[model samples]
Target: MSGANEEPDIPDLPAADPLPRSRWRMQLVWLVPIVAILIGGWLAVKAVMERGENITISFKTGEGLEAGKTRLKFKDVDIGVVETVMLAPDHKHVLAKAEVARDVAGLLVDNTRFWVVRPRISGGTVSGLGTLLSGSYVDVDVGNAAKARRDFVGLEEPPVFASDVPGREFILKSAGLGSLDVGSPVYFRRLQVGQIASYQLDPDGKGVTLKVFVNAPYDRFVKTDTRFWHASGFNMAFDSNGVRIETQSIVSVIVGGIAFESPPDSVEEADAAANTQFELYPTRTDAMKQHDRIIDKYVVNFADSVRGLVVGAPVDFRGIEIGRVTAIHTRFDAQRHSFSIPVEIEIYPERFTSRYQDGRTGGRISDDPRGIANYLVDNGFRFQLRNGNLLTGQLYLALDYFPDAARAKINWDKSPPELPAVPRTLQSLQDSVTRLLVKLNSIPFEGLGNDARTTLRTANALLSQLDTEVVPRAHDTLTSAQTMLDSANTALQPDSALQQSTADAMQELTRTAASLRTLADYLSRHPEALVRGKSGDKP
Candidate 1:
C-alpha cells in the first residue's frame, strides 16, 4: 500500500495453475504400486498351490478343520496346507486336500501316512497341548516305506512303525458288559504291541467279543497255551502278599490293553493259504499242541457231569479254573418237583500239560487218562472251588497242584451220567434257605415261657412283702415321732422353737425324697448291684 509500486493497488491476479502433472510421472507414482500388488497376490497363490504333487489325509470327524487353516507339518515345520476336505464315498475316512511345498513334493509316496495331530491319548499316540494353540494338523512322517508314487490316505496319527506284519488273530470274550472302551491298546511286556480293532456284543447279548490284533514278531509268541487275564485295576488280596496291578503310565490307561504270557516253545504261524475272509467264530482249534482225543472228549461234557453242584460250592476235581456255573433252572414233574438244567462252562487247555511221558514207557503225547492223571498227581495236582464272583455267589472250577497226601482220584467218563435229577436252580437254592427257616421255627418255646412266668411271680411276691411288712412299720414310726415332737412344740410356743423345727423337718424330707429317687434309678439299671451290696440277697 505504501508507494507501490505506487501504482494504485492493481487488483491481485487469481492464483496461477499449480503446475499440471505429466502422464509419465503419474504412471511412476500410482500405476507402479497397483501393478506390484497384483503381482504379489499372484505369487502368493503360486507358492501355496501344491502344483503337480498332492496327498490325501483322513480325520475321524471334520468338525473344526477349515481347509485354509489346517496345515501339514514335518517336524514342527509347515510343509503343506489343506486345500479341501471331502467325505469318503464309504464314509470310513475323511479325505483331505493337501498342497505340498515345492521342496517336499518328492517326499509324497504311496505308503505315506497322514494322521491328524489333535488332542488325544489313544493307542500309541499322545499330543494334548498342540491342539490348544493352532487346532489339529496333518502330521507327515516322511519315509521310504512305499516304492511307487500314489495317493495316500491320512490317518488319525502316524502309522504305527511295526518291524514286520502281524500274525494270528485272537478272539477274547468278556462277560460283564461294557468293561472295555474303544481304541484300547494291546501290549507285550509293557510295550505297546497292537490295538483292539473292534468290539461287539454276542448274539445272545450276554457278553462282549473283542477282536484283538497282535503285531509282528511278538505275536508269533502268543501260542494256544498263552494265558490271557484282565491286568487292569487295583487287585488287592490279603493272603501271601497284597498284589496290586496299576497302570504303568497315565496315557496307557486311557487306551485299554491286553497282555498275555508267552507260550513255551511253539510259535503261532499264519496260514498263508487261509483266505483273508474271516469267520466270527470258526470251529476253534488249538494252536499249540495237538489235543488228546480222550481229554478233549471228557472236558467237552464237563457241564453235564457237574450240574448238581451248589451255587457257592466248588466242583473241584482235585483246584483249576476249568469252568463255572452259568445258569440254573428247575422242572416240576407230575409225580414230584424235579430239576434238569444246562450249565455253561469254559475250559482253557493251557493249564494242563499238552504232552507227558509215561513212567512205564518213553516220552510221548499221552492220550490215556490214567497216564495224564498220574503225571498231574505226581506234580502236586488237585482241583478245588474258587470263588471268582462274590456278588453273584458264583464259583469257578480252579485247578492248582498242591503237594498234599490226601489227593483224590478223578473219574472222567466218556459220557455224562443219567443220574437222578438234583437241585441246580436259583429257585432251588432259595427253597433250601426257606426250609432252614422253617426248621428253626419248630424249636420248643413252651418250657422257656413257663420259667419266665415263675420268675415274674417271685418278683411280684417279694415286692408285696416289702410293701405290707417293712413299709407300713416305717410309716408308723415316723408318725409317732412327729406326734411327740408336736407335743413338745406346744410347750415352747412363745419361743418360736416349733416353727424352726417344722422348717427343718420339711427340708430333711425333701432331701430324703431326692436320695430315694437316685437310688431307685440306679437299682433299676443295675439290679445285680443292689444284691451285691446286700450279701444275704440272692441274685
Candidate 2:
C-alpha cells in the first residue's frame, strides 16, 4: 500500500502544472485534412470561373490542326485552344472543337471568321513562315455581329484583310480572271494600296466578279470615274514609236495584280459608294482609253471587199483616234438585193467638244448628235476605209473631207444614221489594176510582139547603118567644120593684113576729118571770092 501511494504521488507530482481543457479537446493534426479540403474547394471555384466555352468550327480540311496543341490566335495573341478534331456526320468537312477564353466569348459571333495559318505561298507572297518551326495555328477574325455564336464554318483560305480593317470594298467585273489571284495586290499609281479580297463567277455568268479592298486614304482616290485594270504580266507593245515594255512590279509579273486610277480633272468628281460596280480592263492602256463622254453610233455600208477589216479597228479623223469599230457583219440589203458589209462604229463626239464653235453665233455649238452630223455632212466629211498598217494588212475607217466624193445623203430616218462611205483607195486602185489587166489580156499580144520584133529589127539595122556610115560621115563633117573655124580664127588675128588695113583706114579717116574742118573754115571766110575753088577743090 505504501509503495503504491508513493509511486502515485510521485507520478502526480511530476506533472503538477494545470492545462486548459479546450487546448486538449482537439489536436492540430486533426485540422490538417479540413484545411486541405477548404483549399481544394477554393481551387475548384477558381477553375470554374476561369473555364472557357467550347466551340465547334467546320473546316474543309483538318490540315495543321492538332487537338490540345493548336492555338487560336487573334492579333498574334493566343485566345483559344483546339480541344478535339473529328469528321462531321456527312464527312464533307472536318470539325475542330475549340475551347476559347471566357473573355473572348463575345467575339465568337455569326460574322466571325476562322482559318488555319501555316506556311503558305499566295499571290507572290510568303505568309505564316514562322509557323513552320513553331507549328501551325488557327487564326480568328472578330466580327461586328450583335448576336454571338458557337458553331461556325472555317474559311478554306485566309482572307486578304480583316473585315474590321479600315478599308473600302468595291466590286470589279471582268471578262476573265486574268492574272489576279485571291491575295493579289492592288495598286494606285504603281503604289501598293490594297488587295484582291475574293472573287467569284457572276450570278448572270457573264463574267467574274471580284471583291477588292482599298486602304482608307487610297479609297478616297476611287471616284465614280475611277478606272481599274489588270496590271499583271509584262506589257510588251510594238508601234510606230518602238517597243515598250511595262510592268507594275516583279511580284505583279510573277503572280498578278489590279491597279486603279482616278480619271483626269475633265471628268466629273463623285465619291464611289461602297460595293460600287466597275469594269476591270485587261490592260492599263485600255482603261486609260475609256472616257466619260457621249457615244454616237453609226452604220456604214461598204461596197468594197473588207477582207482586212476587223472589229476594234480605230476610227480616226486626220490621224487622231475618235472611235472604234464595234461590229463587222455581212447583211443582204433587201431593197438593193445585194450583199454589203455593215460596219457598226462607235464615235465619241464629245472628244471634239473642245474645238466646237458656232461660226454664226460665235458660241459653243450644240452637242446634239444630229446637229453635229448635219454639220459634218455639209462640210464634205465622209467615211473612207484605209490601211492602218500596210505590213500587217490591218484596215481602219478614216473620216476626212472628200470634196469630190459621190453625192449621197445620210438616211437620217434609219435607226442608226448611215454615214456616207467613199470608195477605198486601195480597192479603187485594185479595181483599176484589174481593168487594166483585163484590157492587157484582151490585146493580141502575139501579133503585137511580132510587129515589135520586126520594128526592132528595122531599128537595129538603121542603127547599124548610122553607127557605120552615118556616124563616119558625121564625124568627117564635124572635122571639116572645126578646120574651117580654125582657119577663120587665124585670118581674123589682130596682127594679120586685114587688121593692118583696118587700122590704116581708121588713121586716114582721122586725117580727112582734120582737113575737112580746115576747108570748112576757109570756105566760110572767102565764101564770095571763089565758091567752087575753095581750099584745093577742083573747080
Using TM-score as the measure, which candidate wins?
2
Return the top candidate by lDDT: 2
Please write out the lDDT profile of model 1 over residues 154-175, one tens digit for every residue.
5544444422344545677666
Poorest stretch of ten by lDDT in candidate 2: 355-364
Q: Native-vs-model 1 lDDT?
A: 0.57
Extract clashing residue pairs from model 2: none
RMSD (Cα, Å) for all candidates, in order, is 31.3, 10.9
Residue 195's lDDT in candidate 1:
62
Runs in model 1 deviating more than 4 A are 1-50, 54-64, 74-79, 85-95, 100-112, 121-128, 131-135, 141-224, 240-257, 263-314, 318-327, 332-539
Candidate 2 C-alpha lDDT tens digits along 410-442: 888986878889888877888999999999999
